[model samples]
Target: MVGGGALVRKPASPVGPLALLHRPVPEPPSSLRRGPLREGAWRSPLRSERTATLLGMWVGVAFAVCFATGLLSHLIQNPPSWFGWPSRPVNLYRVTQGLHVISGFAAIPLLLAKLWTVYPKLFEWPPVRSLLHAIGRLSLLVLVGSAIFQLVTGVLNVARWYVVMPFFFTTAHYWTAWIAIGAILVHVGSKLAIIRIGLSEPAAAEPPAAAVAGGLTRRSFLTAVAATSGVVALTTAGQTVPALSGITVFGQRDPRLGLQGLPVNKSAASAGVLETAVDPTHRITLDGPRPQQLSLAVLRSLPQHTVRLPITCVEGWSATADWTGIRMADLLDMMGLPEDAEVTVESLQESGLYRASVLAPPHSRDPLTLLALRLNGADLHIDHGYPARLIAPNRPGVLQTKWVSRVRAL
Candidate 1:
């Protein structure tokens, strides 16, 4: 039998490794049809291709729903700060936006199954198939690829807040997702024929091989991957679920947040940022065209604005903060920071590797731009980017740039 554990196979050709390797893996002989046929819901008798096709299509539908919802949620939560969607109550954006993550997770098994059924047609290549057929097959592959990326980065985002290893999901995840979605659309449009095939066919035409592998087919590998995605979600869920709120495992929670877990600096003491002294001498800075620079005194003295904004992470976790920093725009205004100005931020602790920042002019001008020195109200914690850190409403947590030491606008 082959490594995959299948039926018999023909002998290998003479000469090389194939000849020496007595059928490293054996597949069932072409004549063998070992398993009893399966009956799908759409089959005339629930055993045909119709049933399988229908089931696969429905799974596809579930994936489609998740994709659309998740994308909208992303746009909303990470909107241009001044961004708006439809004429609906803009207040519901966060709630509606949550659907992107939750539902995206739920689509795992469905999308996998949908692909499993259609993928067989994909290898019918080298035959110069119709343009649409080729496009459709390519699309499905890309969708699967994209879905994988989304899950990976989404998981990483959670790891960041959870303080798990291999941090950096905030930046990496955002970039990959854009590529994934384009692939999704191509796969979806090509499936119109498959949907019709499901609706019109009789039973018995379905394929049993199409059943997703585990949980009696109720929960496939896709489900396992995404369902387990909740590890990060669970880490963050302390705030949402009372039962889970206080329980601590290896201390992932922030004692201050009161429940929902917050990421810790793991090396707060070693993080090396001195927050003990809000020394006026330790001035804030904003460097400008021709390297013009100013002290925090100068920044605060220029013009100040305060905003109550939350830093939401892609890991499906969030934290609200009252940020009090100079309006990025006002500071930039001091040096005439360009609309395309790129800024670099530094922390007091020469220890942190972070250093560059970008200021989206007129954009950062919003009242939400804050250089918070406090959290919830009090001075910022040593672990939470103390002394001061840049917080922006227009960006994901990654872009906020903690541990400020310098700001270079170029």
Candidate 2:
């Protein structure tokens, strides 16, 4: 009634609540609308199912290598009752631990590339479309999280940077590996179908216009990723592989740079055993049926035998040097003990988890086991356990028990 136009609109139709709810809403602009699905809809030019599958295959190989080597290292450190790790080929631990670290480093680039290829799927609509899909997605999340954690922590450990971790790195890394491996197994099983399809598809056609204009093809991108992994391995493999030592600027230790052509992880001063290790009053007490306490002079005068063995550390560095000392078997015999007798070697370090270590019958009886007093024809370096150290085949450098104070038969 007030205005002709306003009166006409009310008369045309009484807009009730039901009508208002059912009214046609104006469409948002195309920029704000969800677009129709199309092949290769991901914005990233590098995103492709085939590319992800290829990268995944390489990553799987790297994981397998890392897992096998890591398991061997764990077993070596904490052998079960039934396991018997070999003591020969003295560089066995060096090679395995080196492979473990190098493979892990190499996998970094592959993992990142693989994630980048499939990252778009992370934002897919309706994340939990089905029960199995939900399980798979959850497992993928675990796999990614654990893999990143393990790699980061392992690298930090290699650098001897313990300040970053709140827990023991070795134990936590070992357990998390099992979890990550289990998730990987499940993810592999779940995605077998997709993986096969992606791999079977004829190589992607010339990538989209964006990829062409950007000057990076899928093949070139994968090659770059592989090259990056290779570079990382080359830079660090020298820690174990002697051939690359001269060029491995990024290695944790230069095997030839420590006291007497070998690296020492913990110096005598750091271990707080310097005074005791170099003291003339120091004696190696042998406790057995015929107990004996021998000074350093008497130990050196005894039938000294020389064996070329490598001191391989858990940190993945090793160096072979001429070690001369009384054989453990010989010493056990002199003490009226059986050749296969189990013995505990105690260190003068006073503190640290590895201050004392037990040698299983097999290791104790190994002819290569020695109560070493000399390295490379010279008296043991102060940092190399001045008076005496234990050097045994297939034994971790830490368990070699520097500054030996006592050997007790068990």
Candidate closest to the true structure, highest TM-score: 2
Candidate 1 Cα deviation (angstroms), residue 202: 11
Clashes of each: 32, 0
The whole-model lDDT of each prediction reads: 0.50, 0.82
C-alpha positional error of residue 216 in candidate 1 after TM-score superposition, expressed in Å: 12
lDDT, candidate 1, 110-192, per-residue tens: 45555555444443323233444444456665667766766655544434443553545544555556666666555445556
